[model samples]
Target: MPKPNPANLFHDLPDKLAAELVNILVETPSIRIERIVSTGQCSDAGFWYDQEESEWVIVLKGRAQLCFADGTPPKTLCPGDHVTIPAHQKHRIDWTSASEPTVWLAVFFSA
Candidate 1:
């Protein structure tokens, strides 16, 4: 097998983004890790993400907002803020920074 390599999370970002760029950095049978870069992006209106795996995500740069189906106030996440969403929880991206790219590291795993 080849030796492991190193990658910079912030390197080689897109210049003009029509949509969020998602890169799967690692994957296993029960787990997946992704690096997502969003620029002024949000979920489609009336849309919600219902995933079978639990997710833990952290913003690495810029900012983002998330809204849940339970009617709680939207949550704003900054560079270091993180959240854990259980499987089947309905959530949506309410907003992302328009001035800069919002880098997110998301880990999805089986409960």
Candidate 2:
């Protein structure tokens, strides 16, 4: 089989409250692929992901605000923004716009 091209795999998914399309590696073990995530607006829910796993996120379109659960001011994320979540850091999606789709790329890998 030919190698997968990251550019060719990119896509925008439908907009829904819990809509998330895994265009790539959806069922692969030890890794995950999430595209076009509409994080929405809520500050009370967050995940205490396993510390042995690290996440790399990129904002492909629209905007959002991400804040670690340590009383830090939210950081604005726009198109082309990228951030890496450490293995042990607990974070949350502080806010995201409903006016426009906030497309994001997330790759999770074990440390």
lDDT of each: 0.93, 0.70
In model 1, the clashing pairs are: none
CA RMSD, predictions in order: 4.1, 5.2
Q: How far is candidate 2 from the true structure (C-alpha RMSD, Å)?
A: 5.2
Question: 1-111 in candidate 1: lDDT tens per residue?
Answer: 954444989887665589999999999999999999998999999999999999999999999999999887789999999999999989999999999899999999997
lDDT of 2: 0.70
Look at candidate 2 and tell me the lDDT of residue 49: 41
TM-score of 1: 0.92
| Local lDDT at 45 for model 1 | 100
lDDT per residue, candidate 2, 78-108, as tens digits? 9999988888777777678777667888888
